[model samples]
Target: RKQRKEAPDDARIRRFEDRISEGKFYLSLSSTKNDPRLMQALRGRLNESAEALGKNVAKDSELRRDVYEKMKALERSLAKAKRMQQEEECFSSKKLHASIVSTESQLRSTRKQASYLTQLAAKTIPRGLHCLALRLSTEYFALNSSRRNIRNEPPKVDDDDDRLLFHYALFSDNVLAAAVVVNSTVTHAKDPWKHVFHVVTDGLNYGSMKMWFLSNPPGRARIDVANVEDLAWLNASYSPVLRQLTSRKTIDYYYYGTHDRGARADPNAKYRNPKYLSIMNHLRFYLPEIFPELDKILFLDDDVVVQKDLTPLWSVDLNGKVVGAVETCGEKFHRFDHYLNFSNPLIAKSFDPRACGWAFGMNVFDLREWRRQNITRIYHRWQELNEERLLWKLGTLPPGLLTFWNRSFALEKSWHVLGLGYDAKTSTRDIERAAVIHYNGNAKPWLEIGIAKFRSYWTKYVDYDQRYLRDCNVT
Candidate 1:
């Protein structure tokens, strides 16, 4: 009975095992048809199966060829992936290198700018501060000089009535300049004694100016130093123009009040000095009234250094005109519009904008003719107009141009050569040939801003060994 049960169980187990094997073979054949690795393996198994089954060899060859193509495609794809990765790395490296170069260039530019700013500050700040301190000291010195009673007797004039008379309204700030002018004039004059110098200074500078002339008198020259306040004719109370000049509004307008407009309009403007509007500067306009005894006067600005004999100036007839000055028509910045505010219709209508302008540094004024034409009244009228409306911004020259417009006789340009102080481009030949070299701008020869090359011309006359100059560090 046991043998019979065991034999039946073993037969059933064998039958189940054969059915499972058949199912696995069909599943593998259907599922692995498209797989490259399995396709390659199946090719070998197919070849053996075909031989066992007695099937066609052509079908086996086709399956093996398809498997070979699939393997080749997979190899090509792997190579392309590697090449793409290398290109990306190369592009990234080049981009990073360009960025570094740009950053370095910017850094170098920043450093250069910083260095330039530092150098600019170093050059300007200390010099500007020194100038400020010097100005304050000068004011105090002038005040002290005014308190002292100093008198300088005028040199005796010979019997000749036709002697050359030179008049200058000098100031304390330009005492050295005045000295140089007188010295140079005397040194170059045909007859030194024939030349007369009438130097009128303000009250503050009267004593010092007189002392300077007395101590260092130009040989045999008639030098008269008088205070502006001492002049009996020039009563400030009588003149509305003079009163307005001392007013707070005019003071502010000239000094630092217009700095905002200047800064916005021109960053490099040279209009920094308040001395342009000083009382001494305006005194020249009162030449006819100042010297009632004189028929003609050769007015010289203190800023000038006489390079040639000024006696020749007296011989040039004014042809009945009040003024004989070098017509600066051909100069770079000597146009009428430069000095006059043509924006006001009154100014625009009153004068020609394109009219030629003349310089005042070396003017030969016919006082007789000036008084006859009433030029002083004309000057006063314009000053009144300016006060009422902002007619012009610059000091004195605008009113002068208007007063002596058609009445001036054009003198030879060689008599006065301007722009030695302001223009660095002024030729050395021009400076040498000039009869009178006028440092007409802000960079006066006495100031540190003056050109070093041109300074020697003015400094040549300065006696640096003098105690006062040495103490003041004028060198």
Candidate 2:
């Protein structure tokens, strides 16, 4: 018999059974060195509410409430823990000290469980998009083979086709969002005829992606959609990431929870985000293989919108660098130390610990330079070393920061402005001047969790008033 898949909440926390013990009971029951004041500080209530909720907290709203309560309760517990540790010789007894250590460990696990649950929900495909995918896929298959449009025509292998085209690479599984990206680019282009878009999606969404573009073709500009899974060069031997993508250990790490104590014991719970494990999220590393013929290409994340003609990016002299992108460190979080492990000498010796990082959502790549410099090999080397996550815990950002360490040219800030997803304080004048805007954080414009203030920037590109979208109630 096949084993049933466990839900995120229970799946992430249950595997940590070895860490939980009767010591939790001891935390609330014990007195700290016979001092009532000290004892009050150490009077920790350890996970009683979650224990009571058990499997009953299954609904999304209930889960949110549980997470909120858990965070509030955890905050109170952290304060109490700090006070107990701060007191002189309080709870210094061996048994009581062990209980404190165990309780802190359990609290860390709770924080991770909460983060995992939130990311699981955030990453889940929304109902409206799922409905759109099914509908478009059904419509695509209903048409005859000749009626299905793959492109304007097979790409001609001629001088005209070889001319410097405004080539773009967008790898995503969201059909509607991909459509918006293409539409926005074409709408804003100074010369749409010179532009070419290359989109890749997982096999499941391939037909849906093709159908959406077929029904709403970008006038003058050509678009080609490829099934990401069918790409020949993405096989195991070529890419370390692809090798891990098929590994049993990797599959279990994402599908079931991890068994690694260090991973489970992580204080930064955001490391548990499922996006870190997604193959599509890391596809940026293999761009040269994806489009070997192109000398230069502009890569766009599905969560971003192009507001101005990007033809000039190809003209921007990379100054012998492999990537041209806007510096993201001005806001203060996208620095090297924030994403990478400086403690590891392997990482520290090669790069600056305090170096500023750049954004990935919209970047110009000098494919020729990338190939000549063999950047892919360096990226693979780092991926191999990080299989056990020794270098960092978060997803592509760290590896991206590493891959182009000293090989990037920073563009003007107005070219690509980020933080539409979670930051509500971005200035209006700054946004108005931005050539491209990125929804980089978790509050995606599609989900209810998206910020209302920033939703307009993304939603404006979406044709929500369309009949099919209306039928799916996508608006």
Off by over 4 Å in 1: 1-172, 255-272
- Candidate 1, RMSD to the unseen true structure: 20.2
Instruction: Give the alpha-carbon lDDT of every model.
Output: 0.67, 0.77
Q: Which stretches of candidate 2 lie over 4 Å from their true place?
A: 1-117, 151-163, 255-269
**For model 2, how does the per-residue alpha-carbon lDDT over 127-218 read when each residue is reduced to its tens digit?**
88889999999999999999887556433345256455788999998988888888889989988877889998988898888898888888
Q: How accurate is candidate 2 locally (lDDT)?
A: 0.77
Per-residue lDDT of model 1, residues 405-455, tens digit only: 889899887778898877888888888988999987656777666778899
Q: Spell out the clash pairs found in candidate 1.
A: none
By TM-score, who's the top model here? 2
Indicate which candidate wins on lDDT: 2
- For candidate 1, what is the lDDT? 0.67
Q: Give me candidate 1's TM-score against the actual structure.
A: 0.66
